[model samples]
Target chain A: MTETQGLHIAVVGATGAVGQQMISTLEQRNLPIKKIIFLSSARSAGTKLTFKGEEIEVQEAKPESFEGIDIALFSAGGSVSKELAPEAVKRGAIVVDNTSAFRMDENVPLVVPEVNEADLKQHNGIIANPNCSTIQMVVALEPIRETYGLSKIVVSTYQAVSGAGAAAINELKEQARDLLDDKEIEPKILPVKGDEKHYQIAFNVIPQIDKFQDNGYTFEEMKMINETKKIMHMNDLPVAATCVRLPVVTGHSESVYIEVEKEGVSAHQIKDLMKTAPGVVLEDEPKQQIYPTPASSVGKNDVFVGRIRKDLDEDRGFHLWVVSDNLLKGAAWNSVQIAESLLKLGLVTVK
Target chain B: MTETQGLHIAVVGATGAVGQQMISTLEQRNLPIKKIIFLSSARSAGTKLTFKGEEIEVQEAKPESFEGIDIALFSAGGSVSKELAPEAVKRGAIVVDNTSAFRMDENVPLVVPEVNEADLKQHNGIIANPNCSTIQMVVALEPIRETYGLSKIVVSTYQAVSGAGAAAINELKEQARDLLDDKEIEPKILPVKGDEKHYQIAFNVIPQIDKFQDNGYTFEEMKMINETKKIMHMNDLPVAATCVRLPVVTGHSESVYIEVEKEGVSAHQIKDLMKTAPGVVLEDEPKQQIYPTPASSVGKNDVFVGRIRKDLDEDRGFHLWVVSDNLLKGAAWNSVQIAESLLKLGLVTVK
Candidate 1:
């Protein structure tokens, strides 16, 4: 192994939203670390953070910051990842990048650990995490694919505000207060902050989740469609996604309609299969009014599946209600799981 | 037209949540009502209400309350409607019932004036308002159905917390506050309050809108399926719904996937049809990331339709997004529109 009992792990963009969560997930899971380096943008370099009960100074996350680091995790932004991820890898540290910069890169392994753990073995220093919505969908759909071959996937997501980062979550809260007090407020940092206009997400549903792609589908929808095929190793898999933003803080719930290749499979059997799946907690009981929700799923790492049922006409088709803390299973947890997989596989030793 | 200028209008259960909206809608729309009679349960009888800058007293609803009333509106619970709507009709007052009690009854015409204004002439004293989800969908789909025959319909709704009534709305607010403030909160009024357990709606999606029926579809889903056919005058049309309650306050948004009988229909054609449809506002412009949002739709009577696209490889399949203020178009506005139609049709005559 790289080190006897500790590995020097540098967290790139450690002060940003998902960056902070990645740090927390690492510490909470009690990973073996010799040194925890907090790296942020140049403007945030003077900041301090408490890691494992000790105050650590944040450094600017440039290519040079990867020097002497074992594994560097990137979650700052797409531009930040595009610029610095390869630099960290060139410095002999494996990079688990959370941004979408390299996810669709043919050579890079877009890993969800549960779906493609073996995909990590061939990674050339950089491992890409799928989009938050795509991550949760693959976790729920992987077991099904293994048992019954998957043919088609149609998912409608009830995505959370935090997926847009910390600013959008704050916007949801502020707008809700302004609405309650009957005060006039303008929306900011939602449906896409860089887009022309923003919409209020406190008590609304935003049909657009990301920038509109050329095919009239939002970038988020295209991510799910593209990433699902890649993760399942089915380049010809039929996938359609309607990514919608809801007024939730943490958890992302999805209504997924999937068609399995096998015939005559019951919803009960699907429910049974998901009940014992890895990183899954089945909470479906329609009679007792029990199902998974974002509020209840906050702060948890498990991808929750509920409301399982077979489509009435299509005997091979089934519907699934999947939910998970978008920040956890969607981002930090999956990233951390990749790091954990790296450790166990001895693919990247901090030597 | 039944002595047009000002007529006596009676509102049953005038002290409840929806009743207040009904009262405000009547005043906001400037309906021609000379005198307004407010009726409620015994416990709410003595309550005072302000309408058009005047305070009216709410009296206990009785059969005699319909006497001398040109038209009566019912928003009391379904049981109260089942017992008292006939009584109001026996007293010669045309009842525009907002409860589910008579929506599916063969004798009662469930009407959304924009969709089935002609159905008003066939009503037998009791005119029923479709469910909140149903009303919005029919308003969006009715224009398309007229131009092209509809064969099969499937819908998955991201409903608001307000659809369960004001208490559920309050619960959502309270729980949101508690969750943001980091306090443990108990949910008591969601996913069917009368059912065994309650779930927090802040970050969750509860698939069961109403109680589960014997056929595995929840009552809310059945309402959409049955009520859509009844409103469209299509008895054998196939329809299915999966209604989910998201933590939104005012508007209900739905992801509707449908297969039409006509082949090679373009999304642009559907957009053109929706533009001229009554009570329909087209908010679709995917290039600039513009579409219908629930927060922007509150306090309006229009049903917002967007995200019109043809499913790839399925020439006859199309996907649409539908949204509306449930309290307005779903309940209050539809009820008031029905009342206005009754006055115009001479179905309600002053004694």
Candidate 2:
């Protein structure tokens, strides 16, 4: 196939929540795709999804499914990615894995296009997408870090339920409805979906996100800490994160406190940098009462940053509120953007 | 009247959210009271409320309302407290002001009974209850500080809408219903109820809890920062806060990062301290997926502390998850406890 003929794109887990978003994002994005294929797990296979006004049939993803696929986007789960990602790569497919399976892999380059697109060039067949919370944060901080220099980061996330999967979203909705109706809620999915104890998310905040590691940080918090360092290429940046799941269903909001290397950096200067930063929207205007909220950031692709303020006692420290659609910018849109970057950077070739 | 006759008690803003909680807390506590009077602004006056199986009519609160009141709890708005708190104090009542009006007053002691009940003895007449967010954090950290000594504190709050007031709770409920029904939401209250712009709180997180100050910190955030230093009686403590309002209706949650003066203090030691700390319930067992959450903390009068872990890079820094009912331990219960402390300390006397 000629370069002008575009490339074949396959979306693994196309029947899932983030997968549907990947299809929609692919349709909306200016990616040159000659063919689009939808693939899901055997349980969800045979489902039909729409792509660019055409109904696409989803087949069970397998090793053979990656044949002739130029780029494959995977978000099924870590197990699926661990099993099939290597298979796809073996078949010459450029895989953009949106799971934690390969995020910390030394051979894999975790790409948040705006923050580390050039890192995509070093990809060895598979590119890892950073965690949803890390994607929005790194995008917002990259500009500030680039200008002010960076030393440390402490983030507390007010994350949405959709990050846990579509089932968790349904649990949030049903639980909320049951609560409003004064019915007893049976929580089967939340915090850690497969954990022994499930807590009600209706009008609640769960401090645990993902399972706890031996170090006492949840896997989600570790992802934010580790993946951020990997993407920023700062191994010793001194990052700490506290990840919490809120009742919100879509956008993920983070309260990030970062210490810059430069002294005497003002919040006004940081806001000015964010205004022109790629894939970043500066939404701070205290007098006008303008700032980003999860509901307002829903369906948006750009990371919204606001509430910029210097730390009260630390002149080099600044705080930011970063928000984005967890399904879009955090997962699907970021995955699709990685594919676009691969094509732009000549990391993917049409066969 | 004999000292054994007990003291008359008055609850200002009786018809409001926190005021109702104050009445309930008073009924539950074994405080010696000759009579309980409910009072509100003229707008909310005449509302009927039940306390200890008896219905009481709310009267228009005036200076005369505190004529013989031994303890008066004020939680109306800042303006109401500003106008009536002094009035209550002048008429022989030891006022427990819940609004921000008198919190910073040199003559008024900002008291969190669990942290600084002794400060209650220094109250000129008005004893200020710290902000809900500040109250919970100080309760959780005071124990640690007593053992290890604290040098710095950085907190990010996931506060409930009820902290904004009764109308804000209504807004959250209505907005949730509207969103669930696929109807357009009109947010009339939240962040700051009477602010120029109102944002939807249903399935959303608003970073601004109160009106933004000139320094870009919200009044709620400033309270957490300033009151923390005062309540802990540390004049040179480095404190920074980022307070955000969540859609939860009752409990407020905080992700706090604190640095202890002593090195080699493990998270296990902190958990052990919290397990025995007064008014603190430790719910931290990562293996059991146990942690304090807002929903679980509702209706409880103690600060629930969990998710205790060491900062990845800062050996002296530890992180904690603190949750408490915004109206209970954060406001009304704290007020009632302060009043109890007053009687225990002989700060209040019947004449």
Candidate 3:
């Protein structure tokens, strides 16, 4: 690709939920793409998607698919990313993997552009996107951490079914319809899709997001705990998360309690800092009843912050309500943003 | 009334959500009610409800209505309780008020039967029921607090719509139907119905519950904070809460993080303690996927506790998942239990 002709961009799992979002985000963003390749598994390979007002046919993903690709956005399962990300990297493509395959890898950089874009410089051809829940939270917390210096975080998430995948979203809708119609539903997806017992998500909350680990915390909770520290480069920061899946379809909301290093910092100072923070929108207005809700934050790229309050007793603690479109800022937009960061940082050059 | 005969019980606001539950709970319990009188506001009066196979007509609640009542349960709003509870007390009736009107009153004992039943002895003919969310949480925590001693509590609630009243429940269902039918809905009763703006609770989560106080905490949150401290009888216990309304119809779930005074207490020990704790049911089994969900906890009188886990960083900190039917254990059942406590304590004797 010539410098003026833009770069070759390939989207893996293009027919999937986050994959489709990646295509749309790429179309909407100012990413320079001369060629767009949509790749999916054999089952979804023949599907067609619209991007930039043009229909693009998805092809079966293969090692040769990345030969001429400058950047590959992967949203398939971890196994697919684990198998293909290395191949894409070897083929001269800088991959922004949106899976857990390499998120905690010592060699890979878990990038949330607003929080740790500088860490992208250490990426070894593959940049891992943080979990959707973690992405919105870190984006909202980064400014506070920078201004006040962070020490501890306790988060309880009200996550959407879309984060589980397109199938889980379908299950939520189907179960809801069945429940409304007074029919029985066999829940096959949610909390953990492949877990032994599937629980209904319609009008209910599941405390477990992913499978439980040996330590009793779900994998999703560990991801938030481990990824937040990794992305912020704070190895000793105390973080605890209770990851829960709600009946919502897209956006994720979190009630975060953070203890700052400074003792006298007020909630107003934190709100003021978040007002101009990168990719952050402040929507807190109690009397006017203005605050971020999942329905209101859908399709938005910015993380919405509201309900900021100082802890009633803890001098150093403050509470926040953070919301964002999980598919956008949490997944697709963050992946696309990482691609933009790669271009801005000159980590990837046009072939 | 004869000495062998049961006492006369009155249920104020009997046509409302919690009031209806109170009538049902009174019927289910072994409380000796020689006569059942259902009372509501003029708007809902004259409605007929069945109790123990007999239809009881709801009458307009007035000060004279409590003249023959030996025990009166009040769950109408705070204003109604403020107006009628004193009248009931003056009429020689023990008022088990389920509103916030007298909960913080110095003279009225705020009692969660399992947590602070002894405080009922200090009641000046009026006993206040703790907030629904606070009632369930305190029940689950009281056992642990008694065994391990609690120092601080941080809770995030996933509350049901019924806590707002029957109108909010109707709004949730209608909004769900409208959303499923691809129609627009005007939200009029959620996240504080009387507040300036309303939000869609169907397929969404609202961060605020009750009106925002001057100190920035929502009244529902402050209720949890203050009531927990008051019911637990720990004046200086640092408690914080973020109460949110979800689409669930009946059950309220809470994610509670607590620091115990004693160190090295495992989560298993806490779960063991809760197993035999009165009005507390332990449902934690990570390997078996056994945990208390709102849907499963609906219509149940017990506060279900699950997902008990020790904090990874703080040996003294533990996280618990507590769920209960907001109307049952949170309101009606707690009020009924207080009446039972009154009978058992010989505070209310047959005349």
Candidate number achieving the greatest TM-score relative to the actual structure: 3
Candidates' chain A TM-scores: 0.98, 0.98, 0.98
Instruction: Output the TM-score of candidate 3.
Output: 0.98
Predicted complex 3: CAPRI docking category? high
Candidate 3 yields a Cα-based lDDT of 0.91
Model 3 chain B lowest lDDT segment of ten: B1-10
Span of ten consecutive residues with least summed lDDT in model 1 chain A: A1-10
**DockQ of every model listed?**
0.52, 0.86, 0.82
**Tens digit of per-residue lDDT, candidate 1, span A57-116:** 999888888887878888989899889888988988899999899999999999999889
- The prediction achieving the highest lDDT against the true structure is 3
- Consecutive 10-residue window with the lowest summed lDDT within model 2 chain A: A1-10
Task: Return whichever of 1 and 3 wins on DockQ.
Answer: 3
Cα distance off (Å), candidate 2, residue B6? 0.6
Minimal lDDT window, size 10, model 2 chain B: B1-10
Please write out the lDDT profile of model 3 over residues B1-25, one tens digit for every residue: 1125899999999988898889888
1 or 3: which has the higher lDDT?
Answer: 3
Off by over 4 Å in 3: A1-4, B1-4
Model 2 residue A197 CA deviation (Å) reads 1.2
Error of 3 at A85 (Å): 0.9
